[model samples]
Target: MMTTIVDLMVFIIGASIGSFLNVLIDRLPKEENINGRSHCDHCGK
Candidate 1:
């Protein structure tokens, strides 16, 4: 039971990190600001 909980936590952390990196990779090339709040490109709200 303890091992399963640890494995789940590790998976969640790894996935979160991967998603953040993916965002950086997609945005950096377009010269977008990563610090600001994210919004839709079509509406520009």
Candidate 2:
């Protein structure tokens, strides 16, 4: 039971990190700022 709980916690943390990396991967190629409100890709609104 303890192992199951630990596994779940690890998975959640890892998934959060993976999600963050995914966002960086998506934005970095376009030279977008890593922090700030979202903007329109074409209009820059």
Candidate 3:
């Protein structure tokens, strides 16, 4: 039980990180400073 819970937490954390990276990748080309704070792909920050 504990191992499964820990594994699930790890998966959740990894998924969250992947999601953030996906947002950055989707936005970096047009509307963001890649080294700076994140914002939507269609808007500048």
Best by TM-score: 1
| Candidate 1 minimal-lDDT segment of 10 residues | 33-42
Stretches of model 3 off by over 4 angstroms after superposition: 33-45
Kindly list the per-residue Cα lDDT of model 3 for residues 1-45, writing each as its tens digit.
999999999999999999889878876666755576655545744
Q: Against the hidden reference, what TM-scores do the models get? A: 0.77, 0.74, 0.65
lDDT of each: 0.89, 0.90, 0.78
lDDT of 3 at 7: 100
Q: What residue pairs are clashing in model 1?
A: none
Please report the TM-score between candidate 3 and the true structure.
0.65
lDDT pick, better of 1 and 2: 2
* TM-score pick, better of 1 and 2: 1
Off by more than 4 A, model 2 = 38-45
Q: Against the true structure, candidate 3 has what lDDT? A: 0.78
In model 3, what is the error at residue 7, expressed in angstroms?
0.5
